[model samples]
Target: MTHSSDLLPPPGDESAGALRVQNLDLNLLKTFNAVYAEKHVGRAALRLGITQPSVSHALGRLRLLFHDALFVRTGGGVEPTPRAQRLAASIDRSLAILQAVLDEGAQFSPATSRRTFRLYMSDFAESAFLPTLLRELDGRAPGVVIETLHIEENQFNVAIESGRIDFAMGNFPHAFSHFHHCELLQERYVLMMPRRVAERYALDDHFVLDSTVPPALQFIAVSSHPQSTALLEQHGLASRVRVAVPNFMVVPAILYRCDYALILPRTVARAFAPLGEMAAFEIANASTWPVNAYWHRRFDADPGHRWLRALLIELFRIGTREPHESWLAIPPNLRPSALNP
Candidate 1:
């Protein structure tokens, strides 16, 4: 009888390159990670940019090496066996550590590098964060490319963790608590209205929402901003909603046409203030939301990612909440059923 370690290749073969780990190839681990993340062999092959048959062959090799089924077929795709689940966190952590070590030696010159940094963000975040961000990048890192994906909120953590997305910028505390994050800025909810509407309601820049409520101060709620609506409801003003729209793209037009007071983030509201279209005033005791930029903990050592995040911090960060160094939480999302390639 021969032992499994006997078949292992001799250590320190330069020809083996970075792909060889211990004795086996790194591609096997990558295949396993992809399949584990995707929950389907076919999707994993697409994610790894390989054929399905190749993934099946790799799975066969993995089964023999581990002496476990690892995964079993399901009606829709595949589910990990108890053994695979046990091996997953260890494999993922090992891979992340190795990648971090490799990144520490890599040099990234923003002026000359052509790496495209992918991001996941909401439409509101796109409008509020991108203009200043683009201007900052224009001079310092002109060669850097940016691609933003307005994906589902639940998908962002998994995407960033897998290195599919570099960062996620938004007011999403619930989704990013498991990752490394920085508070880029904080903004309080504000009551915004056109000059005419403000004047008509005897509202000024010093206006605050208090117990002596004005009956005529109705509200316009953006569908994307439920926080504002919820605030109104909390104040027993649910019936005060006069209009609701899908997003902020049509906000200015609506603000100009209606007398409804719009409640929103002050940073976004200030953009319209300078245009003289509307003015923003702080809502007394209203909830404040932090705009955050989040990335996976594994990228903490990546030079390019670090540079980009630093730039964002310098350009917009106002709060002192530093990035946390904990990997205590995993991405809490299932692969969306429609995420088939």
Candidate 2:
């Protein structure tokens, strides 16, 4: 929808001509983009480092200019109208292009520049990787900020394309040829049990499914990823699964408090092992999956994005040895590193 009045003369002048492109303020469009991204005035203001009143003022101008209520207040937050959604694609692309052009010659210095990098990752990755990465950033890039968002598998590609998420880290089956990716690590499934259970059962480096253990031990199944459950079923351990949880983060506590054992990724199990209550054991047969860092190809040459990519690669580079501390009492060879170089 076009703005009703392109050119504004004196106030209350019905003869005012149409507005021209030259008269538009790019800052207002930028504000609109922020609001569109966050869908809340307060959050958008925080994102843009502006005041809520300013954001509200910008939205008002946008509504008047477009002759449409671009957004409406909702119980949870602001919801974009259909017109806003239609305008968003072009507006976002235009702003991105303008941003790219402006950043063409600008050098990115992480140490001094206050740049916020957003990433989409699962809780497993957060538990495994954030400590080391944050430590590195504290020393090398004091002014840089890092924000992690939960990965919604269905919208992963769209989030990256829209610049809502700078990087996505996980094992995704679909190939995004239009995006750039670097393998961060490869992981296989492992059975994690409380230290007491491991010691009581005399389970060493690997757990062997047997008549003595299969029926007696309770299995904790994660509903988010069924691959692990499927593996258990293939191994005829499906009947043992008594506790089903929606997320892997809850597995550690569940196993610690109960006699249940969890089937999880090796890296995730290792991350939980250091809590001093859990121990990881190799599964009888499990397939490995690669965890990768994905980003839009449009940012391949961006200085800031390039720096961020390098930082992630450096911190998560495939290593010959998994971090020794992830395993509680497991032997060195049995302990898999989170990343493989």
Worst 10 residues of 1 by lDDT: 323-332
Candidate models: Cα lDDT each? 0.73, 0.76
Clashes of each: 0, 10
* Ten-residue stretch with the least lDDT total in model 2: 1-10
Model 2 over residues 98-136: C-alpha lDDT tens digits? 887787657688888788999887767777777777777
Predicted candidate 1 versus true structure: per-residue lDDT over 1-341, tens digit per residue: 54333333446534434433466778888999999999999999999999999998888767666656787878988888898999999999989998977765796788877889998876666766676677767888898889998777677667887899899888776675669888876666777777777677777567677665678788777888888888777777779888888777777777777767777776666544434456556566796678888889999988899899898777667683422111101122321111111
Q: Which regions of candidate 1 deviate over 4 angstroms?
A: 1-105, 320-341
Local lDDT at 25 for model 2? 91
Q: Number of the top candidate by TM-score?
A: 2
User: What TM-score against the true fold does each predicted structure earn?
Assistant: 0.60, 0.63
